[model samples]
Target: MSLNPPDLRPDLAPKMRLDAPRPGQPTIGMVSLGCPKALVDSERILTRLRAEGYAISPDYGGADAVIVNTCGFLDSAKAESLDAIGEALTENGRVIVTGCLGAEPEYITGAHPRVLAVTGPHQYEQVLDAVHAAVPPSPDPFIDLLPASGVSLTPRHFSYLKISEGCNHRCKFCIIPDMRGRLVSRPAHAIVREAEKLVANGVRELLVISQDTSAYGADIRFAEERGHRAHIDDLARDLGQLGAWVRLHYVYPYPRVRNLIPLMAEGLVLPYLDIPFQHAHPDTLKRMARPSAQTETLAEIAAWREICPDITLRSTFIVGYPGETEAEFQYLLDWMDAAQLDRVGCFQYENVAGARSNDLPGHVPEEVKQERWERFMAKAQAISEAKLAAKVGTRQDVIVDDIDADGIATCRTKADAPEIDGNLFIDEGTEGLAVGDIVTVEVDEAGEYDLWGRLPA
Candidate 1:
């Protein structure tokens, strides 16, 4: 699986020329928003900044410089990004903005007057250099030096590991095509090296992420560069060999994904897959500018489950896409009922400014959108509870995350994919555990979205 591409010159650290301030660094305040992919990008920049001797400040109040990594996936997200930029301007410090939102010329120019510069995923490495080489400069001593250890702003136990960047999908509701550009996957060997580094620093779980993970190897110049194709299955195989508990997220269930089911069944990778199938109705999908082969897509899912019987499939549905009829929404709900999905979430469609759907006719009203969203979630919550209840008598491996002040212990299982997913709650007892310790827990009770469990003595 270590198929190294011949053309990619591997450099563990590529040297970049940026002027450095003499003997001092400033405290950096970083705010990362959006999905796991954005988090991974933020992590890389933060790692580089810390390596360059910048002290990280928890709050923006006293920091000498501020960096805001933003999300531009939806209209609401764009508004929040603008709000963050305004807040960063109030700091009276050197400001930097990056991420999909920074790709917008109007947003960067209009909102962030105080920002010294703005960059996107294409210029992440360069942005770090800019932060270091600021003319006003960081006030601390040892400016040109790197930190002795990599600092993680997140909880120490787990981290979001991104495999690649950007998307190639042209779904009408999505603005990623306009914002993040096309899919550009990193070499598998490089990703493995990065994962090894993260593991050395205490990350136990690797969340394999991308906009469209199944399309991983398509952009990779495999024939001339590598002797093989750069695919998610190959990537998953490589990551599984790392011996960390690996998880896959944002995987689209295309026909090619069937090859990955066996890897999931092997237990090296978790029996979980995140597929964002927006809607099940074929006509609705076509109007949304998505793949219209409804039967084939469902057949692929059926085939995957046939091979990997234990797959914990999670997907998302959008209720209010333009031109979606009442019958179409009902069809999606009925499809959900038929699929018996283990985990599911529903989002009401939003008309993003740059997306094509904004101008589409037959837009669902706000009240109607809200009602559909509520109805779908109401059904989904029941299904989620039933699925968790089924596991009430089983023992699952969970990473212990905390012992809260109220004597409640919280953690997550391999089945849960952090942030947006469910958690495992254990009543505090004399067993005595600390964060990052993986233990076997017996589930005793189940709630709407979480499992109540106790660590084995």
Candidate 2:
């Protein structure tokens, strides 16, 4: 996840202050880490504080306290989260920690004993109480009036719309179910209302995220209302009418997900799927405890492509599993050749604490894991090059994201998601173009992982 580690710095939070202000008002600075789900949690926490008349500081220097949202998904992430907490202590002196890593409060306080308080993941009330004890807010309506539109931690042009919380999967290599608990989806109306507000606030794209997007409303049993069920397809179709690009993430390849292909085909949603197919070999998948992995995914992919010819399948894989063999790894590479997935991410398996995979037999050595990771990445890169090369001379609609120091505009096609997937670079003919504007670009250059293009005449 280092590719785009959770953006915890206060710089990512909303630039506008929702709190009006009072004399000697308390200001809180936040540092969020982990996945988009965790990011949403941090946003909610800050929004609550803002409503209570606490000002959000974009830097730690002026803030009375800081909240360090941590990620405990991987050992490496845990170490980084600890380092962030320590930094908060050194820089601000008054610090409270929350997030997945906060589940092990002792582990954190053991490292940063001076932290003011520690709370577990998504414990909004506990976090607020901790902040109150540390630095109480002094609301003066003269300065701080609570606004209906809450503070966001993402760029105003785009926002992450988290549909649900937690997961029910028992993948042996994962401890998410242990930390986040079972799936609990929000009602379709609430999701639509939030998307409506975001779009009204000038958000051009909404990236729908959750632990298991395909399982949305499963726990709700597809409760019906106003002729729409609470399922993802219903939620997605509802969100599509809000005049913004709706992209789905963290979707499992459940058979029922095929119903969404028509929505993509009809331009209601982006023709993209972000599936996490951890491994290809049945034995390795079985060892990982991802029973759904044994499904005929290739056939499913073919059917999806048949429905939406322009669909771009993006997936992540775990290489060097505990019991992975040369044959099993080769099987993954061969399957990649057959799948021709548009985008891919490869991670070397590591023993995350509390995950069942840690004690699994046949643990590959560090050197072996590193070697396999390099080979796996090389193959994925080659595939990316070929896939992108095929787009040369093709014009694609792109949403501008950034203009680099060199004045090149960074953008993404419908096939690309923010931060993780590749981008298209616009080096010329971008007169007066701004971020979030959708425009067509003719592909002029293709790198292994990115493309260069320009506005057409």
Candidate 3:
């Protein structure tokens, strides 16, 4: 999980008197590592700090202390976390290592004695206590650590709103469950309240995220307990009422999720869905412990089209799993062509410890895996261009996100998620444009993936 620092409070007085040294306070810097979920957690931490009256410095050198939000989901992730720790140690400021990596911080503090604290999920409950004790307290009280139903991040015009936490999926290639635990959802009331807060803060586009968004409410079974049936679709419906463009990510294409397509067709939710299909070949998927039959998978996609004809499906595929045959790769390519999916991300399979796929037989060599990835991506690029070309002359409601000094404006349509998907680029000369304002734009040109357009007068 990657983390971003909390949005500073506009109300902070900038100057403050000193309190008795409580621990780690006065000046603060945060480095969040991993995915967007982790980023949200760090944002919450920042919200607490801002409430307490601390000045947040973007640079570590300027702060009295720094916090590193670490990721340990995979070998590469662990290595990156270690590198972050090394960099933190060299700085003169006191350091605190937190997050999933804090699940095991002996690797860090064992080498760096200057580290002030090593904390994990359990430890985080007392974040202010630990930080305050680390340094002398200033006039600012520590920020509230209580869960907030509000956003305190930057006014980026768009933000990722994580509705649930952790994963219940046991895909052998994944370590998410080990790192984040089983599915636990924040209550629907909390989620809706947070959405309102975000919209009030000028976030016009919301990306709903979780390890498996479809599984929301399953563990709680709020549907059964309250004698009222509620599902992810219901959650989406409630969030949609907040009057913002809502989108979903990491949705496993389960039958239950198919039920939400109709909900999405109603126009408040974007027609876009990001489901990680992993691989199209049944045997490869089984080895990864995804356990879905090939026919069932295709049927779900077919159902999506039947429910929402204009649906823009985005998916990720893994190439060269253990025991993958050339024929299996061919089947994947053929499926892509047949499906003609709108947006696709393909990654060469990387082996991670504790994943069942690593123990499976017939692993493909590095060179062959790289070749397959290249071939599939080349085909996907052409498919993307053709799809974009089909949109020329069509108008889309794009929320203005940023305006460059050169006078060009960058924005996103309902079909596009922030940062990962394509964007609508408008000429700088557009009048009365501001970030967070929605405007209609007609596609005048297209490239391989992006749509070029002009704002309506």
Candidate 4:
């Protein structure tokens, strides 16, 4: 087990599986980069393409054209996106670029002018048009039919449900608002309809994601449509009744978020919240132009626990932000000690192109940033170890993610989110355990980031 777990990379996309193309089928390869939000965009694009008779190619050699879904969240991510574009161009000469990076077409084209076209985030029509221009879709009416649930980059057991597009927050360190524009929520009935189809298609977990989940119907005024309200709490209640695990992510700790806790307590949704608490120090938050309510947040956490003791709080933080003093960093460390968050991810701040934080004064030196990151992770690892040790004697309902040929099963508890959180391993007595099966196991062993358990006799 890893003692000091690595910081979660929001840029990582889930592994995708594609079927082999039939004879003379138009095929497209996708290099989907960035977070689950972008992955959802890729899924939508591919679903549209599939409906138009395009087969998804797992590799460049098999594809007639390649689509590079880019991430421009950070400078490093921009570089990565450029590299992916270059690689796709090398492998498949026809390339279409889209995503956050595509918002700045010049930025993408400057490095790779050979790309056929570039479209911004969630521009399905533009992407489809680009694909059609590059690769004429030859849909055989009998073979080219869209699946009910659409093309999903995630496994069939779980899917990322994007509730809205863009964010209204102007956090100095973030450029998302500039790239993706403002919050635009889909209709409440429409979102529920999509979730219903996904559930019917065998998706057991629905990870609700957006730039700001709490702010979900504020732009739409929580408009009600056909028995569903556009509010986050109301949306959660509707999704919970769909007989699937509903996990909320990217939730800003607005006062209204308290309403979701009781839903978790009632088993209407998973008792997990993925909040991005960038820093704990008020001064640091002020510098970042984020909410500086560290004290009130602690109170909120306490209140949430009071309502649902079993709730798993997962948060991401940033250390070494511009002008972050040693005292400020220590304040964050002390806050972590008090929070005792069930799952924690910490990032050493990096400047992104066009981000307001890049202009902020007193940027922390690289050495200081690295040192602070190490210290922050050590504290987090200790907390994780102790918290996990407490669960050693308890029982957890885990969803089987994989069952190996050797019969060892890799599973995740309700507290764990796929690709970002810990896992529970079942090394023996694993007969008949299949992927997507939710089974209860006795927790017998604990480590810093994983647990080992077995089927109860």
Q: Each candidate: what lDDT?
A: 0.74, 0.84, 0.73, 0.90
lDDT, candidate 1, 1-457, per-residue tens: 1111111111011111122333344667777767667766776776676665666666676567778887777777777777778887776466788888877856777766667788875477767767876623343344445533255545666766666677877888888877778888877767777777878777788878788888886787532233323667777887888777888888877777788889888876888888888789988988887843565676777888898887888887788889989999998888878787887866678877788888889988878988888788888888888889999989999987778887777888888877667799988672577888788999999999899987676
Could you estimate the TM-score for every candidate? Answer: 0.88, 0.94, 0.88, 0.97
List, in order, the clash count of every candidate structure: 5, 6, 23, 0
Off by over 4 Å in 3: 1-25, 109-114, 121-123, 141-154, 223-230
Question: Which candidate, 3 or 4, would have the higher lDDT against the true structure?
Answer: 4
Best by lDDT: 4
Regions of candidate 4 where Cα sits further than 4 Å from its true position: 1-11
What C-alpha lDDT, on a 0 to 100 scale, does residue 309 get in candidate 2? Answer: 95
Top candidate, metric TM-score: 4
Candidate 2 C-alpha error for residue 2, in Å:
11
Sort by lDDT, top down from the best? 4, 2, 1, 3
Instruction: For candidate 4, report its TM-score.
Output: 0.97
lDDT of 4 by residue, 244-296 (tens): 99999999888779999999999999999999988988888888898435658
lDDT of 2 by residue, 1-457 (tens): 2422334111122222233334476899888877778888988998898888888877778789999998888776888888888888888899999998888889998998899989988899999999999988777667676556578777678888988888988999888888878888888778888888889988999999988999998898978766567899889898888778989988898898899999999999999999888889999999988948645999999999999999998888888899899999899889988898888877777778899999999988778877887787788889999989999999999999887667789999989887778899988767688888998999988999899998888
Q: Please report the TM-score between candidate 3 and the true structure.
A: 0.88
| Tens digit of per-residue lDDT, candidate 3, span 1-457 | 1111111111011111122323454777777776677777777776666556565666666677877887765556667777777787787457878877776667667766577888874245556666677654455333533334332444456677877778877888787787678888877776777788878767787888887888887888855322223368887887787788899988887777777788778876888888888888887787888835565777778888898988998887878788889999999998888888888876676676566667878888888988898898888888999999999999988888778887789887777766556788998556678878898999999998788999755
